[model samples]
Target: MTGKERLIELLKLLYAVTDEDHQLSTAEIVTHFAGQGVPTDRSTVKADIDVLNNCGIEILATKGTQIRYYFSDRQFELAELKLLVDAVESSKFITAKKSDVLVKKLMTLAGENSAKELERHLYTAGRIKPENESIFYAVDIIHRAINSERQIAFVYFEYATTKSFVPKHDGEPYIFSPYAMLYNEDKYYVLGYSEQHEKIVTFRVDRMKAPDILDKCIVPRPENFDPVNYTVNIFSMYDGEPYNVTLLCKNELMNYVIDRFGDDVRTEITDEEHFTATVEVSVSQTFFAWVFQFAGGIQITGPAIVKEQFRKMLEEAHN
Candidate 1:
C-alpha cells in the first residue's frame, strides 16, 4: 500500500483494535499493519501516530515503560451512547425493526472494544412499538418540506378492528405546512397548518402515509401563534378547546403540577394544606383522566361548566 493510504488505514485499525481496555505498543501496531497486508516498520508506525495526533484524532497514549497507545475522546462516550440506545429502545414511535436498525447504527460510533460494552444495554423487548415502519422516511419528507418553506401532502391513517392501517377520510391526502416535529410521551408528532382544518394542527407521524413535499409555498405562520404554548394545549396529544382552568392542588403535589404544566404555572397559596393554580389546558377526556389520577389532591375549582363536565366524566366512569 502507498504511504498516505497506509496512514489512513492505521487510523481505522486503531479504532478496530484499541480502546482503554485494549491498547497497542508501536511494535504491535507494526504487526497489525502487516496483518492488514500493508507492510510497515515500527518507526513508520510511530511517525504515523504522531501525524494522527497532530491532526487531533484524540488517540491517546500511556507514558509507562511499555508506552501503549489507544483511541480515546470518542465522538460519543459510552454513557451518552447508552442513553441514546435506551431512548431508541423505549421510543413508541420507532417500529421494532427500525429501532433495532438505529441501535446497530449507534453502536458503530463506539470503538471495537467499547462497542461490546453497549451490548448489555440493548433491551427492546415488550415495549409497545408502532407497527408502521415508514416513520423515519416520513420524517425526512416532512423535514424537506419544512426546510424548503413549502407545503406537504400525506394520507393520514387510523387502525381498524383487525389491526390494519385504514386511511382516514376515504384515503384522501391532507395538505399541510409542517411547523415542527415534536417528541412527547415517546411518540413523534407533527405540528403544522392544515389546509382542510383552516388552522394549525398536530398529527402523529406514524399515522401518516405517502408523505410528499409540495411545490407550493407554506402559508405564513400567524404572528401571534406560539408553538410552545400551543403544545401545552394538546395534553397527551389529544386536541381540545384551550381553557384557562383553576385547580386546587395539595401542597405536596406541587412538583406534579409543575411537571405537567411547566414552571410558569400561576399559583396562589390557598391554605395550609392546598394551593390554587390557574393554568391553561386543552380540556379533553385525557386531561380529565390525568387529573383523576391525583384523586382529591387536585380539583377543578372554577368554570362551573368544566367542573360539571368532570363530574359527568366521573359519573360515567362510575356507572
Candidate 2:
C-alpha cells in the first residue's frame, strides 16, 4: 500500500484498539497494521505512532522491553460520536461551510469508509435554517458550565411577561449547575439545578441571555439523575407535577401520536376514524400547548381541570 494509505489504515487500527483497551502491545499493533496491507517494520510503526500522537490523536506509549501504545483519552462516547455524525448530515442551523469543516474533522476520526457513508446519507437529509444566535450562544455557555462544573448567572426571559431579567433585573438571575443540553420538539433546552428554587429546571436555550460564569464550582451531579428519563417523564423539559391525560384523536393523527408517545400507551380505536390515547405525563404549560396543536383532531378527555383548561383555550381562541 501507498505510504499515505498505510498511515490511514494504521490510524484506524489504533482507534479500534484504543476503543477496547487503553493500550496495545507492539506485537498487537504490528499484527493489526499488517492486515491493512502495511508492512509493519519496528521503525516505520514507531514513526507512524509519533505522527498520530503529534496530530493530537491521543496516543501514548510506554518504553520498556516490550513497548505498548494506546489512546490516552477519548473526547466523545461512541453514541455521542455517532450523533455528531448524524448532526452533520442533518444540520440545518450550521452553515454549509461550517458543516463541511465539521464533517471533515469527523471523517478524520471516523476513518474513510465511515466518513464516506455518513457523507452519502447527509446528502439526502433535510436541511434546517440557521438557529437563533441567542440559542447557539446559550448552548455554548451551558456546555462550558457543565464541563467546568461551574455555576452560571444569566438573564432569563419569561415567556409570560415578554421581558428580560438579569441578576437584579425585573426577574432574578438564576444560579445553577448545568447538567445537559436536551433537544425536544425541534428546540434546545439546558437542564440544570436552579439554586433559587432549590430544584432542577430546564430552560429553553433561546430564552437565556447575558450569562456570567461564577467563580464557584458546583458539586458533581447525582449519579442517579438520568437526563433522558428526566426530560421524557417531565414532558420535554418542563418540570411540573405529573398528570394523566386522555385525548381523542382522529385516525389521521393517530400515527403522529403513536410515533411520539409510542403504542404502549393505552389506546382504543373508536369507530372507523378516531382513536383515544391516554398517557400520564408531566403537566406543564408547554405540554398543554403541544396538545393544543392538533386542535379539532384531538380533544382532552380526562382530569376535569385539564379538560376545562383546554375548553377555555378554545373559547379564548375563538373570541
Candidate 3:
C-alpha cells in the first residue's frame, strides 16, 4: 500500500474506535492496523499519531506504564449529540421515515460506541408525525425568500372528510411576504404579511405547497411588530386580536400557569388560596375552550367586555 493510504487508515482507526470514555492503547492500535493489512510497529504508530496531531487532528494522549490515545474533541459532544437525536425522534414536524434518517445522521457525529447508546435510548412508538414530505422544501424556499427579500406564492390546504388535504379558497394562490418562522405546539408556522388581506398573518408551513419565490420585493415587517409577543399571544395558532387578560386562579395551579404562560406573567396574591395573573393572549374560541376545560379553577375577572364575550360563548354552546 502507498504511504498516504496507510496514514489515512490509521486516522480512520483513531476516529472510529476511540472516544472520550473509550481509549485505544498503542499496542491495540497496532494490532488493529495489522489486521487491516497496514502493519506498523509501536514507534511507527507513535510517529503517525504525532504527524496527525501536527496536522491538527487534536488527538489526545496519555503516558505512563501504558500509553493510550483518544479523539478528545468532536463537532458535538456525545451528550449534545444525544440530545439532538432525542429531539429528532420526538419532534412531530418530521415524518416517521425522515426522523429515522435524521437521527441516524446525528448519531454519526459521534463515534460508533456513542451511536449505539443513542440508538438504544430511541423510543419512537405511536408518536404522531406529519405526512407532508414537501414541508422541508417549503421551509427551504421560505428561507430563500426571506434572504432575497422577495415574495412567495403557494396553495394552502386543509383536511377533508376523506382524511386527506383539500386546497383552500377553491385552489387559489396565496401570496405573502414571509417575515419569520416559528415553532409552536410542536408545529412549524411562517409569519408573513398577506397581500390579499394587506395584514400580517401566519400559515402552517407543513400545510403549504408549491412555494415559489416571486419577482416582486417583499413588504417590510411592521416597525411595531414583535415576534416574541406575537408568538406568545398566538395560543394554539388561533387567529384573534390580542388582549391583556386577567385571570383569578387557585394558588395550587401555579405550575399550570407557569407551564402555559411561562415565568413572565404578572402575578398578585388575591388571598391565601388564590392569586390573580394578567397575561396577554389571543382571544379566540380555542383560548376560550382551554379556559373552559379548566373549570372554576381559573376565572377571567377583568376587562368587562372580555368577560361578556366569554359568557356569550358559553351560553351559545349550551343552547
Candidate 4:
C-alpha cells in the first residue's frame, strides 16, 4: 500500500490497541499490516514511528531488549474521561438514548484497552433521564439564536400525570427572544422576553420541542439586567414579583444563606445567635416553601406584605 495509506491504518491500529498498559512489538505491528496485505519491516516500521512522533503523536518505545511501543499523553487522561462520563450519566436533561450514544463516543477517545476501564465505571441510561429527545437539538438552536441576536419559536411542554409530555395552550408555539441560558437545580432554562407574556420569563430547555431560530430579531435585552442576580432571585425559576425580603437566620446557617443568596447578600449580625439578611427573592409558594423547609431557622423578618403572604399560606394550610 501507499506510505500515506499505511500511516493512516497504523494510526488507527495504534489507537485501538496500544495504551500505557498495552504495547505492540515492531514485529507484531508488521504482522498485523501484512495480514492486511501491506509490506513493511522493522527498519521501515521504526521510520514510520519517527514520522508519527514528528507529526506530534506521542508514540514511545521500550529502552532495553525486547522493545515494544505504546502511545502516551492521550488527549484525555483516564480520570478526566471518567469525570466527563459521570457528568453525562448524571445529567437529567439528556435522554437515556442520547446519553448512551454520547458515552460510547467518549469511550472512543480512550484507547481500546483503557476504554474497557471506563466502561466498568459508567452507563448513561439510568435514573431520571428526560423523555424528550429533541432537548439535545433544542439547546443548539437556542445557542445559535442567542449568538445571532435572533428570536426563536418552540412548543413548551409539561409532564402529564402519566409522565408523558403535554404541550401547553393547545400546542401553540411560544415566540421568544432568548437572551441567556441558565442552569439551576440540575436543569437548564432559557431566560428571555416572551411575546405573549410581555415580560421576562424562563423555560426549561429540556421541555422544549422542535425549537427553530426565526429570521426575526430578538428584543434588545434590558440594559441593566444582571443574569447572575436574576438566577439568584428566582427560587427554582418560578415567577413572582421581586421582594427584598429580610430573614432572621441562625448564625450557624451562614453557609446555607450564602449558598442560596450568594456571599454578597446584605447581612447584619443581630446578636450571638442570629443574623438578619436582606435578599431579593421572587416571592411565591416555592420561595415560601424553601423557607418553610428550614424549620424556623430561617424566617421572614421584614417587608410586611411578604410576611402577611407567608402568614396567609400557613393559615390556609392549617385550614
Q: Which candidate is the best by lDDT?
A: 4
* The 10-residue segment with the lowest total lDDT in model 3: 229-238
- Count clashing pairs, candidate 1: 0
How well is each residue in 163-242 modelled by candidate 4, as lDDT tens digits?
98799978999999999999887778999999989989999887788889999999998999887778877744278988
RMSD of each: 2.3, 9.6, 2.1, 2.7
- Candidate 1: C-alpha RMSD to true structure equals 2.3
Candidate 1 vs 4: which has more TM-score: 1
Can you list the residue pairs that collide in candidate 1?
none
Off by over 4 Å in 1: 121-126, 160-164, 235-237, 315-319
Across residues 256-298, which tens digit of lDDT does each residue of candidate 1 receive?
9998888888999999999999988888898899899997899
After superposition, the stretches of candidate 4 with alpha carbons farther than 4 Å from their true spots are 120-126, 159-166, 235-237, 263-272
The lDDT ranking, best first, is: 4, 3, 1, 2
lDDT of 2 by residue, 170-267 (tens): 76687878888888766677787888778787877666777778888975677798887776567452666788788888989977786767667689
TM-score computed on alpha carbons, candidate 3: 0.92
lDDT of model 2, residue 193: 83
Report how far off residue 217 is in candidate 2 (Å): 5.0
